[model samples]
Target: MLLEGERDTILKTTSAVLAEHGARREKLIPLLQAVQEQLGYLPKLAMEEIAAALDIPAVEVFGPATFYNSFRLHPPGEHQFKVCMGTACYMIGGQIALDSFERRLQIKPGETTADRRFSLDQVACVGCCSLAPVVVVDNFVEGKVTPTRVDGLILSYESNGQKVEQDSQQTEATNTDEAKGEEGS
Candidate 1:
């Protein structure tokens, strides 16, 4: 189901992308890519709009969308964790790392956290087979990640996230105060 405001944004953005590509069916791939780049994922409504703009069936849009591994149907979480399940990684306890994350985050692969803070996904390979039992957090690969290390990593992310939020709030308050002072002057 699409939220009203998000749906409107998706429709508008998709339309603009189609226009930029001259609304040509040959530009379908680029059209989809542009929409995904803007929205972080391909929302269903956006896909439908793209099909309509190209005068194609929604299934045609959906088929290619699903076929491309890079196109995500759902919005990505603020933090994405990709676990490598390659032969070396699996042999070296990558499964343990994945299980630890599932337990700690309380979400399985291809799912986001309840708080919408994190998402977990498993990849066939990260191309770093040498880094067996590797976990890539936000794009930084952590090699030889153990269950205990997972705990520390989660704690650090949570703590750092909180600190950043607090800092942002403080900065906003300071800015507001300065603005009020200037207005009074």
Candidate 2:
């Protein structure tokens, strides 16, 4: 559900987009794209408004929205982590790396952190097979990812003035030691 302010913004943006696109049925995909480009995601109310403007059912708007992978119904967080689960990556501990991120961030794939700082996702492939077990952090591909490396990555981001939670401090220490061990091997 969107807050009052967010709902108002969505409505206004959707209205502007509709005005520009002229509510034509043939312009559905382009209109959706324009709205998403402005708002970052398509809100439910915006879709309904689009349906009404186009003289179509809400399901008509929703069908293509849900069908397209490029469309995101939920707003993304400030940071995005897209873990590749391609054949090569999966064979080389990609799932382990994803599990590590989930444990550290306390959020599963396709979900964003409560603070809206981070979002996690799993992609089928990124076409970087040579760099198997890859994790894409905010559009930068991180190759050769591992569970210990996941901890280090999170810590690197959290170290930017945000204090680590008390409970995670011990886990960080343990992970640091484990990273050292892995480096020596």
Q: What is candidate 1's CA lDDT for residue 29? A: 87
lDDT of each: 0.81, 0.85
Show the colliding residue pairs in model 1. Answer: none
Model 2 stretches astray by more than 4 angstroms = 1-4, 106-108, 159-185
Candidate 1 lDDT (Cα, 0 to 1): 0.81
- Per-residue lDDT of 1-185 in model 2, one digit per residue for the tens? 46559988999999999999889999999999999999988888999999999999999999999999888877787778899999999999999999999999998887778777788889999999899899888857778887866776677666662333432455568878889999999
Report the C-alpha lDDT of model 1 over 71-108, residue by residue, as the tens digit: 88767778888889999999999999999999999988
Task: Please report the candidate that would top TM-score against the real structure.
Answer: 2
> What TM-score do all the candidates reach, one by one?
0.71, 0.76
